[model samples]
Target chain A: MATVRAALVQEASAQFTSRQPLVLVVDDDPDVRASLQDMFESVSLETAVFESTAEMLQHGIPDRPCCLVLDLRLPGTGGLEFQAQLREMNQFVPIVFITGHADVATSVRAMKAGAIDFLPKPFRQQELLDVVSHALRTEGEKHRDGGERNTVRRLGESLTPRETDVLRGVARGLLNKQIAYELGITEITVKMHRSSAGRKLKSISVADMLRKIDLLGI
Target chain B: MATVRAALVQEASAQFTSRQPLVLVVDDDPDVRASLQDMFESVSLETAVFESTAEMLQHGIPDRPCCLVLDLRLPGTGGLEFQAQLREMNQFVPIVFITGHADVATSVRAMKAGAIDFLPKPFRQQELLDVVSHALRTEGEKHRDGGERNTVRRLGESLTPRETDVLRGVARGLLNKQIAYELGITEITVKMHRSSAGRKLKSISVADMLRKIDLLGI
Candidate 1:
């Protein structure tokens, strides 16, 4: 468990210092891509520019917290359609849509589909940068949550069956005698199993054990 | 606890039957207000029309799950400004913005402020209805979640001090002997308090008690 936790901590620090947060741009126009690339680069943010969804998908997103700056109208598949496809694939990269021509219906559709922000043509540079910052922060939170859940699950997998039963009874507010009666074991045995389980999980208190159990859905 | 739960259930049913879902409309033009009222009423929805934010505030929203259909431009306060005020007042009624001239910046701002949808003028009737339905459903979920949190708090308040101590220890996976040592009570006394707390909270298992304790943030 310590090793796993250490690895996660190291990975997080490595990401912060060694790897830069990325901004993906998918626009058919070369000028727009170049200008956007410059804009993101000016702020010390790494960016990857592509001409279309096909080109972006071919390269795939790197293993880092990232967001997409996509044009609404592309060469073949529209931005909305690409968003739907990503949802189907369970790729929840936050998206900010840029459009040359904006209508209410399309904007509503894009927003409803979970686009981070919709910007019509000639949008302010600062506005796009602010939205991208928000998107990256959101991605960071999501990654941390996922990592914590995985850690909890791994810790849960370390307990013995009897230890699990004893801890489960404790989490539910049951007395040792009551747990023993239910499991047809001695109250002393129940206590032993619970303490052993607590040490294994490194739970300092009943509340911590309860939380980990809840996180593990046990 | 039972009485509180029952009252909440009764209140929910009362809201569903006696009180129909409401759609509040705020528009400067009387014609727009009248047309929106007519549209909502056609679907058996009750509506209150107002010429401005002041008029709506004066009337006050009824105690029910509801949404707002707001015009972007109003006489006194703009739609965006009114939305901000509602947020500050902790009034989170879902909003659907309607505008004659749609701009990306304004639409983005509205959506960021938690507006349900933004529709430009000459929007399809069905589109407006669909958005209203979604907004009402969102409001219903928020109300139910609030009710549940309150119920959990009320249940937490019912525990005696000793009972709460024993339960908190149990929720953290503490053995009866350990909890008794900490509280300077006999193990038998700890067991008695555990059962008593479980009975009061109607907790069938340790997992259930753990969840209730977590919800109470103990």
Candidate 2:
């Protein structure tokens, strides 16, 4: 196990410089770790394998979008307990649990606590890969240009009530006349509000305004 | 089953006149439905019981905050399949699955597809009630005053960039001078922006501004 851990760390460190999405695996069984390492690496995903939650915590979470593939029945702290611990520590890492001893109650508990997906052991390689891709994509969305989001949010905060209503209607694909009818305003007023909103948001096109509205998440 | 369903409908119709959150139950066994109906009503909760998804659909979803308590293995459409069908129809009612045939795969699938809770048969009454309360609470959040949300969002959309920054800092509990320092502006400028934002939002107090910020869900 020591030699396997050392080899895994060396391989992971070598791949870390590439800044690719990471998949962290924690299983007491060395063979399972090796198999997962090979499987994730086959899809060009970097992996850091550990024998227990303690070891993974010791190494600390990588500063990258990553998902944890955890074994349900670990040596010391179980996967569910470790998940709670991470939550208490405010580490919101996505987790996918695998277990040979699958039970409905435990699976329900894990899902209720926000495990991304739970897979019974001897699962398909494709299933695991697809779930990992989904988890990574969710994490990536959170990590995307924070500065850009702040700017968009600030711009969204700059509209008047009428301008916001016009833009939101536009975002919903409403025509200016339809917006006017909905708001009980004239079409000319709708146009004025639309153009004024565009100016305030510094957006040149309807598509750009739509994108900004999406960013506001209304 | 027809007689049992009729009795259930008659009882439910009598209770529907009162405006209360409804709990819809669909289970094949008459005994189970009766038990659930009694349990829910014992706590003063309104319930509509059905033997299958077809029957529930025919009865129609209640026009208020509600949740579905579905049996996993029905004679016709199963619980998980019915959940998918509901999503297809865009009903989005929260669901809690109760099944005698407990399995990991199905539980995980149900949870992944957005089930509020999955319970194996012969579960505790309190556990089921707690989960139902949670589901109803979630549904209630969505049904909250849409007009108020629109008003708050429009007010949020009316803040200038600097005013937004100042207010966001305030919402995070930062002092006015600290916000000024962070924004590379003077303390007086921070106060000016804050006052302007308060007036624009029609929020007379810091607490009101904070509530508005929360409503914007930033």
User: RMSD of each candidate?
Assistant: 5.9, 16.2
Fraction of the reference Cα-Cα interface contacts (below 8 Å) that each candidate reproduces: 0.64, 0.58
**What is the Å distance of residue A174 in model 2 from its true position?**
29
Candidate 2 on B42-62: residue-level lDDT in tens? 998899999999999998887
Q: What is the DockQ of candidate 1?
A: 0.41
Candidate 1 clashing pairs?
A172-B206, A172-B207, A206-B171, A206-B172, A206-B173, A207-B172
TM-score of 2: 0.63
lDDT of 1 by residue, A138-189 (tens): 7877777766666677677779999888877886778899999999999999
Predicted model with the maximum lDDT: 2
Q: Residue-wise lDDT of candidate 1 within B143-192, one digit each (tens)?
A: 77766666666667778988888877886678999999999999999999
- Provide the DockQ value for model 2: 0.23
Model 1 bad stretches (over 4 Å): A1-19, A153-218, B1-19, B157-200
